[model samples]
Target: MQFQILRDEEGTKADFLDLLENFKPALKEIRTATNQESINEFIVKQVPYTLSAGELESIWK
Candidate 1:
């Protein structure tokens, strides 16, 4: 799925968190189909955030 990051800073955090929450299933599906390394690479390529280790772990769970 194609995703876009909002340009405004005002709602960035909430927007990102919402996307993270909503995209959990898709993320899990990707993980199931690919290795963690590949999924991480794909996330970095597809999403806007520079997700930290903790954040990545939280979502994956």
Candidate 2:
């Protein structure tokens, strides 16, 4: 149910939109878990942590 579309720089915008429109019905058929359902499915425990300003800056770099 995943698609990776490559867009050409020279392609017309209308054509790209039309191609996407073709997938509308199929896209509607795709199902996704709700936030609570997704959290319930994860087996690992998540811990929250605070990052120091210096650590955050280095992470961006």
Candidate 3:
């Protein structure tokens, strides 16, 4: 969920973005971002990840 905000830049508070940029000056706003399933695909390519059975179960809790 944290990574979703990073990828999409949607419904994010402006102050939070500024605070994040303050610590790491390299952080820049993405002008054109997508809140799509594509972000998941991009992440899987970089590092293969699998949700454990417990993790899956927790989602509906």
Candidate 4:
């Protein structure tokens, strides 16, 4: 998932967080009123998740 330029310190592009929630709807169940922690953890986890893959591939492809 890609994060676009922030509209503000606490806001991002309209669909940023929605991407992950759409990928794994169960995430919404655990989501807090604010998405800060979820967003941080997702980005940090992406480093390892992407590196372990053989090649970069977009799910859309």
C-alpha lDDT of residue 34 in model 1: 53
What are the Cα lDDT values of the candidates?
0.64, 0.35, 0.37, 0.40
TM-score: model 2 vs. ground truth: 0.33
What's the best-to-worst order under TM-score? Answer: 1, 2, 4, 3
lDDT of candidate 3 over 1-61, digit per residue (tens): 5445544554334433343344342322321235223433443443223534443223222
Candidate 1 vs candidate 2: which has greater TM-score?
Answer: 1
- Which stretches of model 3 miss by more than 4 angstroms? 1-34, 51-61
The TM-score of candidate 1 is 0.53
1-61, model 1: which lDDT tens digit per residue? 3354454443454576576787788777767535667766766676556777776677787
In order of appearance, the predictions have TM-scores of: 0.53, 0.33, 0.24, 0.25
**lDDT for predicted candidate 1 compared with the true structure:** 0.64
Off by over 4 Å in 2: 1-9, 31-61
Clashing pairs in 3: none
- Per-residue error for 24 in candidate 4, Å, reads 1.9
Q: Residue 14 deviation, candidate 1, in Å? A: 4.1
lDDT of 2 by residue, 1-61 (tens): 1122323244343443445466555544552445323422321122122334443223222
The alpha-carbon deviation from the true structure for residue 10 of candidate 2, after best TM-score superposition, in angstroms, is: 2.4
Per-residue lDDT for 41 in model 4? 50
